[model samples]
Target: MISQTLTLELKQVLGALLFGSRRPISVADMRRVLLEVAEQNGDVGGRFAQTSA
Candidate 1:
């Protein structure tokens, strides 16, 4: 699970990105963004698809 601190940070960034878009953020887009953030934060070790660590 993403720490509370990390989740807040990601939400802030995601909010900014979403607000900048012409349309609402889609589920796929959000998932892609979150997965990217998870990789950067080294929080993907728990998921089989993200076992790159």
Candidate 2:
């Protein structure tokens, strides 16, 4: 599980990205941005997982 601080930071980052955008962002784009942020912060471990759902 990720820490609360990291979660909050991610939320803030996501919010900034979303709020600053003029056009709608796609899921793939958002996921890529989030992964970039996580990787930058050295939080790219098991934080991202692919499910067949």
Candidate 3:
């Protein structure tokens, strides 16, 4: 399981990415961004499961 703090951090990142955007964000796009962040943080394996849903 991922930590609540990490989840909140990801939410913040997502919010930043979506803020002031003209186009609507898709699930795939969010997943991709999250996966990138997870990979960068060395939590890709653990985070992947959550993203699948």
Candidate 4:
């Protein structure tokens, strides 16, 4: 389960990505970037598994 603080941080990061994008953001693109960020942070313990369409 994602902690509230982490969830907020993720939201902020994704929001920034969306805000800065020049084109529509696809789920695949967001998932890929989120996975990469999770991996870099060593926190990818299925936190994103429920994000599937």
Best by lDDT: 4
lDDT of 4 by residue, 4-51 (tens): 644436677689789999999998898887776666666543465345
Clashes of 4: 0
Off by over 4 Å in 3: 1-8, 20-22, 43-49
Cα shift from native, residue 30, model 3 (Å): 0.2
**Model 4 error, position 29 (Å):** 0.5
Least accurate 10 contiguous residues by lDDT in model 2: 44-53
The order of the candidates by lDDT, greatest first, is: 4, 3, 2, 1
Task: Compose the digit string of candidate 2's lDDT tens values, residues 1-53.
Answer: 87564343545666887999999987777777766665666654225322111
Candidate 3: C-alpha RMSD to true structure equals 6.5
Clashing pairs in 2: none
Estimate TM-scores for all models. Answer: 0.48, 0.56, 0.55, 0.61
lDDT of 1 by residue, 1-53 (tens): 87564333644656877888898887677667667666666644223224231
Alpha-carbon runs more than 4 Å astray in model 4: 1-8, 44-53
- With candidate 3 superimposed using the best TM-score fit, by how many Å does residue 3's alpha carbon deviate from the native? 22
Clash totals for all models, in order? 0, 0, 0, 0
Which is the winner by lDDT between candidate 1 and candidate 2?
2
Question: Against the true structure, candidate 1 has what lDDT?
Answer: 0.58
